[model samples]
Structure formats: C-alpha cells, structure tokens
Target: MSNSTPQKFEFQTEIKQLLDIVIHSLYTEKEIFVRELVSNASDALEKLRHTQLTEKEVFDDNLTLEINVTTDDKAKTITIQDFGVGMTREELVENLGTIAHSGSKAFLQALGESGAKNSNLIGQFGVGFYSAFMVAKSVKVYTHSWRKDAPGHMWSSDGSGTYEIEEAEGQRRGAKIVIELKDDCADFAQDWKIKEILERYSAFVSFPINLNGKRINTVQALWLRNKNEVKDEEYTEFYKFQAHAFDEPRLRLHFSADAPLAINALLFVPKENTEKLGFSRLEPSVSLYCRKVLIDAKPKDILPEWLRFLKGVVDSEDLPLNISRETMQDKSLLEKLNKVITKRFLKFLEEEAKNRAEGYTEFYKEFGVFLKEGAALDFTHKDQLVKLLRFESSLTEKGKTTSLADYVSRMGADQKEIFYLVGPNRASIESGPYLEGFKARNLEVLFCYETVDEYVMNNVREFDGKKLTAADHADVKLADLPKPEGALKDEDVTTLTKWLKDTLGERVSEVKPSDRLVDSPVIALNADKFMSPHMRRIMKAMNKDAETPLRVNLEINPRHAVIKRLFETHTAQPEKAKLVAEQLLDNALISAGLLDDATAMVARLNKLLESV
Candidate 1:
C-alpha cells in the first residue's frame, strides 16, 4: 500500500479455507466477532506498550492506549478504533488485505526474545481480522505505522473472496476498524446493543473500551491483577457481573501458578445454589481466557460438571487451544490444572471451616450438596472432596456437623468399620431399633438424610482405611455382652424362636437370638443383605409392581424384659401372644419400608386393648 498507486490481490488457498471456517462454523455465537475485534485492538495497544519500552524513537507514544468503539444505527455501521502501533500502508496490506507476512510474527519473536513469556500478542493466527465479516458486509482498516515517514493506508474487504488496498492521507498511530453491518446484523450498529455485548464479554479487558464515545468496559482483569491490591467490594462486584448473580459470593479463590502451567484464576462460589431452590440446573459459568481476552465465556471442559456452582474466570497463556475443535489438547495438563485449582479451593475450605466455622457452616448448608456430588462422582479429586463433606451424626447435636475424619478420630480401638444409617432423620433412626446396639456400646453413627447420600456412600466405599457400613445391615454382628436379668431362659428361648419361625414362615428368613438388641425386644434384618436402606427406598419408588417381597431375619433379644413377658404370656395365652407376634413383625416391616398391610396391625392393637 503506497501513495503512488493501489494493488488488489487474491487470497491464498489456506486463507480461503480458514475464511470459510471462520465465517461458517468457527464460532458458536455471532456476537463473538465483537470480542475477537476488541481483543485484536487490545493486542495492538499492548504491542505499542512494549515498543515504547525498547525503542527510543517511538512515534505517537503519547496517544492513550485504549479501544474506542462507535456505533450508528442510521448509518448501519460500527467502528472499533485503537490508539497504539498503527500499521503503515504496506503493513496494512500484509496484515489485513493478505496473510503473507504479519508483524504479529515479528511481534511474537521480539517479545519472546525479551524473556517475558507472557508478553501478550494479538492476531497471532491472522484470522481475527476477517472475523468482522461474520456480522459485517464490508470492513475498512485505517492505520499509520510507528515510523514517522511511513504512509497510512486503508484496506477494504467484503470478506467474500478478495480485498483491495489503497493509501490513506490523514491517520493517527494504531488502527481503526470500521464495519459496514450486514442486513441481518443491523442491530449491532445500535449503541445500546453493542454496549450490552461489550459489557457481557469484554468487560474485564485491560484496555478502556468506549462505545459511542462513552466508556463501557470499565472493569479490570481482576484475575491477572495482584490479590492484595483488590478490595472485597471489587470482588463482590466482579462476582455479580461474572456469575449474573445479585447476591454476594459465599467464597472466593484467587490464585496464580507459574509452574505446571502459567495460570492466573479467580473463582467464586455464589451465596446460593439456584438448583437447590428448584431452579433450572446451571450451565458452566466460569469463563476461560488468555491474557485479558475471553476465549470461552462458558467453557464446559475447564472444570468438572459438579463445579457448576462456582463462577469466575481462568486465564492461562499455557493453554494451547486446538483452533479446529475449540478444545484443549494434553488432557494430563488439563488434569494438572484441575488438581492445582481444586486443591487450592479445598484447602481454602479447610481453613474456613477451622477459622470461620459459622460462615462456612452457612455456606455448607447451601452449597454442600455439590461438594458431596464431587466426592461421590469425581474420582480425580475424591479424597480431597471427601474432607469437605459434613453431616449430622448420632454423636453430634442437632444442626451440628461431623466430618469423616472427626468420626474416625472418635472411633473405638476395636472398631474397624465406620457406621452410618440412612433414614429420614435422627428421630426416625432412633425410633427404629437400628441405634440400640451402637448406643449400648457408646459408638457413634452418621445419620444420612438426603436421598443422594446412599449413592455418595456407595461410591466412596471407604475412607481412611475403614470400610463404611450400615448400622442396620443383617450381617453386622455385634460384640457379645452379658445377658440381662429379665431375659427368657434357654428352654423358653428355643421354643419361642421355633414358634416365631413357624408362625411367620416365609416372611422370616431366620429367627434367632439378637446380638444387636440391648433394650429393644426384637429387630428385623434384611435377608437380602444387598438391599440397603437407600436401595429399598429407590426400589419402592421406581417400580410399584416389584414382586420381591422384603425378607427379614427376625431376631429377638432373649434377655430383654419384653421378651421375658412375651415368653410367659405365650404359654398362658397363646391367642394374645399370636397377635403380639404379628404386631412386632409389622413394626419391623414398617421400619424396612416394606409394610403394605397396616390394616391388620391396627385391628390387632384394637383387639388387644379390648381384651385388656
């Protein structure tokens, strides 16, 4: 591009293919064109910033390095202009009109030689300039190089196939991009609409972005900035903007890592879990960025699915994006990123739990379900996630929480298994006979109340070398203890056990003396030991026609006072004893969630009361 004449050239084969992808399928959202152009502008400003540092004879270094955007609905055009490192006529032709040789390569080479690994370079691939065609019918680039003698040029392109270059007379340093909007994308020429897209996507760009001569992107890239320089109010405002959340963030993690990969990230946990409130499940909100430019505003692969509750930004220069797939390669490196960030967050939780118990408790009450989900499903960080889980247990007061570590610390020397009982609540489990033996032995048991607790427990399986077991399982053999005074004798126990097995028949898998019962007269255990409390509830809820009637092992504490009384009464009044046996069995069936026949139990109780 020279002042003497103008030359038009055809695109290269690779440029044509790249243009097809960029215009058709490279970006999922058309609004991304704005982000790409703004990013390119920021890169130009950054290049000027570096050029001033090394070169003494810099031209127009006084111009403020900012991106100014202007939109006009009447004209159906939008203009994004920067004031740093404008290109010369030949430079414009090479950088915009064609992709033969871009200063971007030289810019990258110069910055890389400076030993500044993260020197932000824009237009590395030369495809960002053409993205304007996604929403524009034609585009014009006006620029003057840092060299004072070099002439400014205007490169115009419809981006259909070819572009033309000509010299321009009056131009400041840096570049000005004017977009002639397409008919379908005419709305972008409106100030309000373009401002909205700028605020949503490029709000945190380092450079000042002004739309219609007014500043729009005012927020700085907090992720890349020093944490000590940031304020709580700033973090809160950022969280609100990034997450589209009105409430303050419950927790936040600001971190930077130079090893493994050069990474800088600021993550937030919202004050509430919308999904818990019966809202629609949240899509991933944490965005991915390189330097200050957003690459993916809703990246699905940056974090695990269970971490959708977290919101913020993750920016890394080391992340090599597969331009074709828009996904990252080197999964192991991604895992490393996942591990480093997750570990830092988990460590933050441990600190919060220790130093700020009340606040952490509130956060746990709202967002704890997600941690449990990760612990149960994400094996990569399961161990770390498990430490963050908290639950109410038999040993804890109401609303108090105990972690697996705390439970393990309190376990008796002889106890080799961690005990947990799944039920509606503490009262339900207490009312049932499951807690009797643990209570007698002064052992603690975790109370799982949520429906997903079963799945969590199964996936976890074990923690700290102790196997997790259900307190009410049939196979759980309690330690032998001395018999109580009012218990049935040897002969009476044998006869009663025989009579119970015969009377209950198929309903009773095996009637025997109870090892788990200390006060309760009888306890029923599932004959199909595989069916846990959670499993039974699932089966009952899913398939109404399931023919598998629950078979339970009926066990009676021979030494209990109720057993002694029942033994004497059976011989004295066989009819009353039969009714009592049926009532006891019904109680166990109800506890196991298998009792469909409540009508008989009521009638039997009425008959017994009348006789009394």
Candidate 2:
C-alpha cells in the first residue's frame, strides 16, 4: 500500500440522480438490497469460475469460492464478503463513480423519459449494485484485483454526491462490502433478518451462501440437473424443502426446455390435496425464479389458477425483471412461458397415464379435481387436460379408472357419443335408471361422483370427436332393443303417457315411453337444456334464492311391471292410479337428487296404503 492519502472524486451527474432514486424509490421492499448484492456476488463468482478454466495464475488461489455474510447487531453493521473476481483502483472509479459501464446513463434517460411510474424499464439497464444505498448509512467496498500485481483499495461512499478511494493492505482477492446501517434500518444488521432475506431470495444461487458461519442454501436446484442422474430420494427431499411440505410427493415433473423460452421447472403433486381435506383454498405455491434467483415466491400469473395445488419452482434465464427484480417486464413472454409449462405438464401427465397406470391412477384420485378445473376453464390446454382426466366406468371394475382416450378407444363403431351419468357415488349411479338401458345394451357409461364433474363435462362439451352426452338428459337417444315379453302395446303406452301427463299436470314437462330405460319403472330428465338436476341442486346448496323451478321430462319404461300395472289401473281405479303416478314421479325425483319437499309424497304414500 503506497498512498496513505485518500483521493476524492465527485460522482457523475447521472450517478447522483440514480443514488437519489435508488435510495428513496427504486425498490418497494428495503430488504431487496440484500438480494441484489448477493445476486451480484454470485454473478462475479460465476464469471471467475469460467475464467479459472483459462487463466492459471489467479490471485488468492487458496481462498474458497463462497459468499460469507456477517452481521453485527451491536454495532449496527452488516458485511457481505465474496471470494470472486474483484476490481482495481481505476476500475472502481470507472465502475462506481461514473455511469458509463454501469448502464446508469441509459437507465436515467429512460427513467426521465417514461417517468418514475414506468420503473420496469430499470431492469433492462443493469443497476443492481447501487441498490445497496437503500439502507446503508455509509458503504465501504474493500477489494483487490484478481491480477497478482494489482494492489488492494477501499472505496467509501455515503451515497450523497462524492466518494473517496485509498490504497489498503491485506485485502483479499475479492470484494467485501461493509454497510453501516442507518438508524431506521438497523433491523438489517440482525442475524435472523439477513438469514431470512437470504433464504427467501438467494437460496438457490449457484454459489454457496453462508450466513454467520452457517450454510443458508443447502438444497440444490434439482430442476436444472439431468433427470436421469437425480435420485428419487433427492427429488422427494427437494420437494419437501421447496414446498415446505412433510409428505412425500405423489407425482413430480422435472423438465427443461430450450426453445420458446429457456426454462427449468420442478413441479410436485402433494400426497394429499389439502383443499379436499377441508383446508382453506390453496393459493399458487409454485414460485418463479430467474436464473436460480427467486423473482416472485407466489407469482399469480406464472400458472393458471387451476394449477394452484402444484408446489415447486419454475426458473427461466430468459426473464427480464424490473429494477427490484420483483416483476417481469415482458408480459407476452410470461404468457408464452405459461403456455409452455402448462402444455409440458399436461404432456407429462399423458406419459404417466400411458406408462405407469397404477401410479397415475393414485395421483388422479387426489389431484384430479385440479385437472378437471383446468379442463373446464383453461381452454388453451383443454384438449390435453381432458385427455388426462380419469373416470370409473360401467365397463371398469370398482375403483378402477379410464382416460377419455381409452374410453374412446373402447367405444364400438356404432356409438356416436360418449355417455356419462352424475350421482353421489358408483352405487347410486349404477342403481339409477339413467344407466339401465346403456347397461342392457352393454354400452359403457362413465360414473361421475363429484359435484364439479357435471360442470367439467358441460364445459368440456366434447372429447376425441365424440359429444360428451349426459345419459339422464332428455335429449339422449338410445337405439331400440327387442321389445321384452309382456310389455305394453305401443297404443297403450301412448295412452298411458298422455293420461299420466294430465294427472301429474305441470309437474311433468312431457311424459313419454323411454328407449333409455329397460328395467326401471320411470326416469326423470331435466327439461331445461341449460340446467341439469345436479346443477340445480348445486345452485340451491350455494344460494337458495338462486334455485330455479324444476321441470322434468318423465320417461316411463313400457316393459317394466309398474308401468304395466299403472296402465291397467288408470281406467279401473283412477284415484288409486293417480296416487301411484305421483309416487313414481317423487321416487324418480329422489333418485335424480331433485326432490325439494317430501311432505306430499308421505301423505300420498299413506293414502296408497289405505287403498291397498
């Protein structure tokens, strides 16, 4: 160290303006300074690592390549030391005192042109290092050039207007920034505060980060690694760490993409769905990272709302963040990113369903609601999401599931539409009249148990070129089967339907002989094309005032014993037959989950018992 005297220099005009903006308005959160500084240190280390491959004679060759953060609450001081490529005296003047190489000149120009409200432009210009002035009272940068002959120097600034530089002794090969914390920002000097900030934003930095001699970033960025080399246990551990979850992941998708946008994503489906377990609605848990540095912990636009159940990380190097690195500047690019990740995840599900049927079935049982939501709402991925949907069908064993594609493949050439029935469970759906004719004809029908299943079906509308038809809908048309022995004649069936419609009055929209019923006495189909019985019930449960009046197309099976008896009793015992007709409509309503009041049915049943 030759010069004992310090040399002073004034900051450039742009630097002076930048200091004011950064100190007062650049970042919304004051603690972002720590992330900015740490990110810069990691960048320097990465550059040095690349340089090490070519240069043999590096200064301080024995120093470990790591970042150490020390905090002293007693003295209100925090120091960040990184053993990476440092700067010389002239380089410090060029880097810190002027706006030439730092891109501050352009940043200032853009800031002035667009005004402070348009701050997203700040990120396009590199000004990360100056973010430290947000909380620092006085900043001291002690650095030594990586070149062997370069001397150590200390650059001091209070970020007012000017700075001083002086030769120093015993400085390391890299930069060490000591920040004298302002009185209002003294919390930053606390060990716990810094540790929290580091773990939140800098946890996945390529270089090791140590806070107060304890490692902060221990978990690796598994998304960026080759899938074949990563162990299953490692994935589980990473999922638990990233998701803050205890149970092992039910499914994991770790993938990388180069085209469209360079992206690396590690997504996990938790072992249990918390929302299904009666927990509060899930928020978006998949965090967004830019080059391994966390940009947003819960980025709302990163994924569709239906994918809120997923937990993990999505890191892309192509992201251009604003000055605070808090939000992305290019919205179209972000949308492209969303499309890519969503399509890739849906593709991953397709592969899982094809190659690992049992495991996919287990995942579907827990997380299938989310896929259904996506299938109903996200039109961009509806085809793929619909393909990933699983359902128990009349053809499959209990608890077994089939994909839409598989269901389509099993369909006979004569079948023109996909058939499904919604009820409380497999037993209710099987016992219901809606599935009888399909079962009699050996036609498979999907059994939907959840309330959302109807809405999903209604929105998805069609899959694999076949219309998704509700078996209970009045519009359904089934092929005729051979008339069973002892069935009502066509003339008697028409007369019975007309008499029942007159007896039931407005309760029945239109009574007719059914082709979609084989053994059941009668079935109630919703008359309204827009609202099904199940959907009406759902609306009533949510808001009673929202419920609409019920109108049904009652279809009676001509071949069933009850219908034959009703046909016979209509003219002989008219009052007794009226009671039977009312009771049958109520019974069908009960099976369809459309019954609002049973008082009338109870009184009618008493009258019928008296007549018997």
Candidate 3:
C-alpha cells in the first residue's frame, strides 16, 4: 500500500451521457475539439493573469503565458500545452471528474456580473476540456498548481467510461493535454490541418496561439479596438479574414451598446450582393463571439433575417450561453441584441442616404430589394426601412429616385396622401392615362417598377402620417381642374355617361364624367378596393385558371374629341355607337392589364373598320 498506484474513478451518469454526446453528436464538426481545448487553455491562462494581480508567491511565475501546439503526424499525436494556473490532485478530481464543478462557468459568470471590463473570459461550459476525447484514442493531462508546495499530477483517460490519476514529476505550471489520435482522426495530428482549424475558430484568442512552433493568430481583434485608432486597411484586412470575402466592403458600422445589453459589433455591407447575381440565398455571416473567442460562426437568430447579408463580428460579454456554447440559451436576450443592432444598422443606412446621396443611389440599385422585403415583412423596423426606400416619381428624372420623406416635403399643403403608381417602368407609367389627372394638377406620383413594390406599399400602408395611396386606386379623388371651352355641355355629358353604363352593363360598375382627366378619353380603375392591377397579375401568376374578371369604374374625359364624337354618334347611329363604346372600354381594359382575351376586341375592331 505504501507503493504509489494510480487511483481509478467512474464518471457520473450525466458525465457519461455528456461525454458520448460531445464525442459523437454535440458538435457537428470534428475539428472543433481543437478549438474547445485551445479555448480552455486560454481561459486558464487568463485566470492566472487575473490571479497574479491579487496573489503573491505564485508557482512558476516566470513561465510565458502562451499556448503551444506540437503535432506529430508520424506518431499520430497532437499536444497542446499552456503555462497558466494548473490544477492540484484534489482540484483535478473536482473539476475533471465531477459533472457540475466547472471552473469556466463560475469564472465567466463572475466576470459578466462583476462588469470588470475584461475581454479574456472565454469558456462557459465546464465540459469543454472533455471535448478532446472526440478525436483522441487516449488523453493525458499533466498539470501543476500555482501553489509552490503542491505536487505535479497526471490524469489519463481512454474515454471508455473510466479514468485514472497518479503523481507525475517535471510538470509545467499549467495544463498540457497530450492526445493520441485515432486512425480515422489522424488528420488532426497533421500540421496544416490543425493550423487551419486554429485560424478558423480560435484566431481571435486573447492569448497567442502557436502551431508546431509557428504563430497562427497574428490578426488583432479589431472589434474590441477603438475606432479612432483602427486604420482603414486594418478593417479591410479584418473583413477579408473574418468574412472570407475578396472585395472591399461597401459600408461598415462599428458600434457598441450597453443599455439593453452589453454588445460590441462590427458589421459590414459587402461591395456586391451575391444573391442579386443569381447566387444561392445567403446564410448568416455575422459571427458571434464572447471575449474574442469564437462561439458560433453563423448564428441564425443573432440578427433579423433581412440582415443576413451583413458580415462581421458581434461580441457580447453578457451572453448567458448554454453548456455547449454552440447555441444561445436566452432567446429574449438574443432578440434584444437583434433589435439593437438592426436599429443601429438602419440608422446607418439613413445617414448614408442623406450624407452620400449618389453613393447610396448606387447601393440602392443593387441591394434595395432586401430593404423593401424588410419594410414589408419586419414590422419592428418597417417605418425606418420605408423611409430608406428610393423610387423614381412623376417629378424625378429618368434614373433619379426620391424618398418618401422627400416626396412628403414636396407635397402641397392641400395634398392629403402620398401617391404612387405601380407599372413596368417610368415610360409605361408616364404614358398611362392614370397619370394624366395628376399631371394636369401639377401633382407628383411615385413610380414603382418592380412587381413586389405593390406588395411593399400595401403592407407599409402609410409613412409620416400621410397614407400611401396608389394613384390608380379606384378610391382616389382628385381636385377639380377648371372646365375648358368647347367641352361637352353638362346635360350632354350626363346623357353620354348614362348611355355608356346602360350599354356596358355589368362590365362597368358605374360610368361618370371625368373631373380629373385632361386629355385621355378613358381610364379604368379597379372597383374591388382590395385588388389593384398588380394584385390581379399576382393572382393570375399563382393559378392559370384564376378568375380575374374586370370590375372597374370607367371615367370619360368630357373635353376629349373622341368622346365628343362618340356622344353625337350614339344618337345618330346606335348600332355603330355600341361597337365604338365597347372598343373604347376594351382599350382602357388593355391599358389596365385586365383584358383576358383579345379575340373579341379584334373582332369588334374589324366590324368598326367595315363601317368606316
């Protein structure tokens, strides 16, 4: 009994289940074992760094605080060593052998709750040290405590349900994990393989990381750096390295928040939108970090879906991470982070739109569709997003665009609604009869070109207290223009309207003399307040046999020559007048994009030609 022998210990039930899950399924990528172990070593070094300020007569005080990785492909082994606060035999039994005695969890909670303003806190789960078993056939950890009188010890495990601990000599002041790689997992022992994994997940570790005697994490954590001191080239390099992007960023917002939650974020808008170039939809790229250590490279709910195009890093010391640190634990805290960052980014866009109008116009040409999607779908930021929307209008030039705020500023005091018209292009919208009324009264109308514009406007509803009204909507009522000379008399106009209604019957909801029209003979507006021409087109696109029967109000321009002649022809020759009336209505229907079959209109035109 006097002779020293290794003492064996059995893992708790929870520890066994956790070990199996971590080795097999907890982490999707096997290479993360390196990251997890490196992170643990970094945390141990950080604790020693903090402990030195308070304690005197520490063990191995002269040891450098850095991590060293020595990979041996011949022996199929990877060894990670750190010179920090090591563990005692009793400490090892409690931390490594017990399920709930996690030093990282207690340390991180203290760091967060204390608000000590240190960025070295890394691991959250106490089980991160066990992640080495994922690729290790056998693992040995040699550690020496900081207390000068404590003896060195070695803990060895095959990860087959039992572990053994015994005294060891010549151990360093901190922990050294020696992993014997399995046959299939031998690649982890290669120099290039471990280096790549280190750069991807642990590049931002507060402590220096060396792989096979070569320094790997040379890039600084720029998000934590002060903006005034950070150079543009530094940000560019960080963006390229962090986002894996080649081109320079189009826009960048580096900000920190403490109110709703403590957060430091550096977000970038890339020069090109890959989705616009017909690439697959982008996944989230804003990596989530805690104290410079990578947590999740692509967190789904870290930001809103609309901000998925953004690339950069978001670090929050306040995060209440789960045991794996792979997924967030508090969803409400995550939502708060999302709202704060999204609002800040939207504010950045608003500034860009105002301060650099030309540059923003170029950006809008490429990425504005995303903003429109958010405006319609994200209710929390809809108003701010709506304000950022730019569109060509009746008053704007061919390529120029105006914002809703700008449109409202140009509105007359008598104007009560913000008017917009949806069409294929500016040419089609300007040439349409619906624009004639607005043009005559010197009123401007926004020109919407995309099919989604209708949906966006319908969902946005209003902006800045002014209702967003489609100019072609059936409910629109324009102010009366002065009556022109040689126009049809009041009685004649009334008689023509009644005759047209009677002849058109159910095809027309009601016929009326135009108070808004100036030169156009007729313009059709949808009678169903809910359905616009764009809505009808959307319905037809969804279902081929969808019934889009026309139900519209027909307005006749009393001053137009065609209508004056039609009134005279109505009484002189009722038979011919009916054909002309039907043809005129069909022309208006064609303009509204509601004419289903052109065969009837072609036949009617031929009959009228015969009469001529």
Candidate 4:
C-alpha cells in the first residue's frame, strides 16, 4: 500500500524567494502562521462543502466537516487536520513546489517591483502554506483527495529548496499538516498557545474548530447572520464575549451593506464610558476582519480616532490584502470602509434620537464628549455630528436639552445667529451678565458647560445656515430690546463711556453703552478676535503663553443704578469715579475667567468702602 521510493522536486525559482521571505522576513508576529494555516483549512473545507452538493461517492464522506488541531509539547510537533477536500500527488507538487498556476509568479513580480517596503504582499498569491516553514524545522502534509479513486500521498519539505513526495497508506480524505517545530519555536507545540491563537483570529470562522478534542470557536459570527434571527440575549452574549466586559452594552448597531465593499459590521457602545470615568485613553477596539479571519485586532485606521470608544468588529470580504494579511494593500478601500461604517453609525444615532429621545439623552450624558470631539475635529461628518449635539438653552427647563434642529426651529424668523455662552455650569451661565440681554429680548442662548464645547462650536461654526456665535464675544450684535424708563439719557451714556475709556487707557479697548446688557452694570468681551476669554484661560491652564495684554470691549448697562451713579460721580468726584471704573473692569474680568491678579481690585475695593 506504500511506495518505498520517494519522488523529489526542486521548488520553483520564485517560490524559493517566497519561502525565504515568508520564513525569514515576512510576518511581524510568528503566531500569524496559525491563522493562515487555519484559514487555508477553512477554505478547503468550504470548497468540499460546495462540491458535496454537486458530486457523489466522495472519499471519507462519513467524516465530519471540521478542523482538528493537536499539539505535543514533549515531541515539539503540531498537527492541523481538516476533514475536507484533500490533494493528489500532482496537485501537491503544483500547489507546493511550482509557481506557474498558483499566482506566485505575479506575487513575486509585485514584490520585486515594490521592494522590501511591500514585502507583506504574501496572501494575495495563495502561498499561505509557505508560512508553515516560519516555525517548522520540517513539515509533512499527508493528504488523500476527495475523489473515490485517488490514492493517499505525503509531501515532505525541510524548506531548503527541494521537497519529497511519497505514497502513504491509511490517509484521511483531507490534508493533515504536521509541523516539526524549530527549537526557537517550540512554544507553538503547546496546547495553550495554539488555543489562544484559534480563539483570537479564527473564533468566528463558519466551520467548527477543535483543539485537543475541545471546541475553540463556540461563538458564532452574529454579524453575518440575519438581524431578525439574532435575539437580544444572543447579541448581549456575543458583545460580552467580543468586548470582554461584564456590563451590558448601552447601544448596538448591527448592519450590513452590499455596495461600497460588502461590509458586515456589529458595533457596540458600552454602558459606561471608561474614559469618562477617568480611565486611560481608549485605543481603537473595533477589530478588522476579512472573511471572518481577523486582519488587525485594534486597527488604528479602521475608524477615526474620535470613535475609539466604540467596541466591536468590522468585516469586509472585499479587502485586498497582501500575504501576511497584516496590512491592507489598498488604502482607498480602507477609507471607504471607514466612511461607510461612520455614516451608518451616525444615521443609527439620528434614528435613536428621533424614536427614543430619553434613551438618547442618557447616552449623550455619558458619551457626548466623544461626539463633541468628532464635531470639532472630523470635518467629513461635522454636519451630521452638529445636528446630534444637545444643549440646555434659555428656553428649556433646567436639566432638559435641545438639539440644534430644535433650537433652529424655535429661532425667530429674523434671528441671524445661534447664540451660546460657555461657563462651568448652567447656574454660572444663567447668573453671568451675558445671558441677561438675550433673556430680555426673548432670544434663547445655549448653555455650554463642558470644556470642549467652545472648541466644538467654534469649529462647527454654523448649523441650519445660522452662524454659531458666542453670546459674550465682542462682535455679537443682538436685536435691541425696548429701553425701560429711568435709564441714563443717551447723551450722558455717551459721555460716561468716553470718560471711562480715557480713564482706563490701554486696559479698555473701547468702552460703549450696552445694547446687550439688561440688568448688569458691565460685561467684558475679549477684544482679540482670534482668542475668546475662555480659550485664553484654557491656554493659561496648560501653561502656555496666554498673557497677551488684557484688553476687553467693556459694555455698560445705562439702566443699572451703578452706571447711572457713575455718570454723575465721574464729573463730581474724578478720583472716586476712576477707582470705581477700575474695580468694574476687574469684576468683569473675574466673571469672564480672564483675571490673572486680584490684588489691585482688593485695594480699590477697600478704598471705595472707606469713602462709603
């Protein structure tokens, strides 16, 4: 039943070079060889399954369609057996020793053209089998073709140019590759090592995978299944398994697309934002998979950095990857995958906001910072992200939030801008002088509390064709409200403003009678068009040079009692009035979060009290 003589053959010229690259320099991680071998087994099994539908009288037809892996630490040998379609002697020689029809020629040509920079172009040419030599001192493939008449054969190679093939007795229907591990790679023969590799890259493969009689890939690839058939509990289980978290997901998006790269993505937002809880910055967790085999576990470029909080998998069958399957060969296709997934996720958020308002609000409370970051930095999705931003406004009750679309809906027909004020919280913004003018005019101003809000608003710039203007900015021009009785005369208001400007000198860029102040004596707006007072304070906190000379466009409410009295006191008591003017500027600076020193204000306050 066995042939005593073995037929020996030299490897094709290109295959010799390929073996050198694959064995010596191709893969960054040696463990990738496990994934490649298992993926090849899966492909073989899949082919047999398709063939079974059309053909009859197959060899080892009674054998179950699965992959079996065995590791022997003492012997330093690892064996992977697939009970699927096997190979004939001629087929083995053609597949393993030659490059004529295996596409290895084109692969080598591409490698030569791209040089070492593109050395990762391995898997494109169906040479995944060569990866075995990376860890093996010698490799043996015992196979029997599925055809009833085909005989069993064993192909052996030490990966030094030539390989030997001989007839072997009692072989199974599928290929069984036995790798005699090199001394340095003996760890590959450990059961735990191979098990870990199986669970990571091949866990979601269609067929069952067994290691030492225990099933490894028990969890199914739910993303590939119909959404209607997948239950909530099943999704939850899969999420916990994939994300390695105990807490349930807050939101899940399970979707697939045919066009734009045949994508099947399952993304989850965990119940808690770990980064919000003061944990270390999150890395991208959405793994990239091609045909159920993981390409990258934490692919940095799969999604925009702002979306790092998301956890799940994005599998595309259309990826054009190189040999190691380590790096994607086509960058534009990867970008397309990013765009498609991002837009779909954004659309899901919009639907959730529309149909489940309360739930979306809770999610926004925990994860809104990420959206703000995206809105500020990701220009491609800025418009959609801006619409999803929610904030409390003068018109909404405290704790209630309004979307930009809702805010735009409530805007007066003549209102030209969306006004917002940044402060530490709602109370601080409401108490600030800037809100009074908008409140009196019945113009709603959004309350922005987070540190990133200003940056988001500044970058988003506009929504619904209305500019996003900071309420306290110097350039803001609000609709004038009716002047109440007992206010200072127009002439006196002008005189007081001119006198204050002359008294304050360089400290005041320009003092003017306020159209935007209703009840407060004064409000200070940063005169520097480039930097807001809030931004200046942030710069100072970061220890950057924010000490550009303090100059503010001070606006005084003519109706306030202090301003009316100051108009009278300036002419009668010039020294006292000058002290009052300086104190007011400092008060405004403190309120604007721009005051660097309060020593002068304290002295001025003591003098004013003594006079009183």
Query: What digit string (tens of lDDT, one per residue) describes model 3 on residues 451-545?
Result: 88999999999999999999987789999878889899999999999999999999999999877787789988878877888899889889989
- Kindly list the per-residue Cα lDDT of model 2 for residues 377-495, writing each as its tens digit: 99888888998898999999998888888898989999999999998899988878888889888888999999899999999999978999998899888888887788899999989
Candidate 4 colliding pairs: 121-323, 122-323, 123-323
Mind giving the per-residue lDDT tens digits that candidate 1 earns over 442-546? 889999888888789889999999988888778887787776676667888899999888877887889998878876778888767567646876887798777
Q: How accurate locally, in lDDT, is each candidate?
A: 0.77, 0.85, 0.83, 0.85
lDDT ranking, high to low: 4, 2, 3, 1
Give per-residue lDDT, candidate 3, residue 117: 32
**Preferred candidate (TM-score higher): 2 or 4:** 4
TM-score of each: 0.67, 0.67, 0.68, 0.68
> Candidate 1: which pairs clash?
86-174, 487-559
Residue 592 shift from truth in candidate 1, angstroms: 3.2
User: Model 3 scores what on Cα lDDT?
Assistant: 0.83
lDDT of 4 at 41: 90
Off by over 4 Å in 2: 1-220, 321-327, 545-547
The deviation in Å at residue 544 for candidate 2 is: 2.2
Worst 10 residues of 1 by lDDT: 115-124
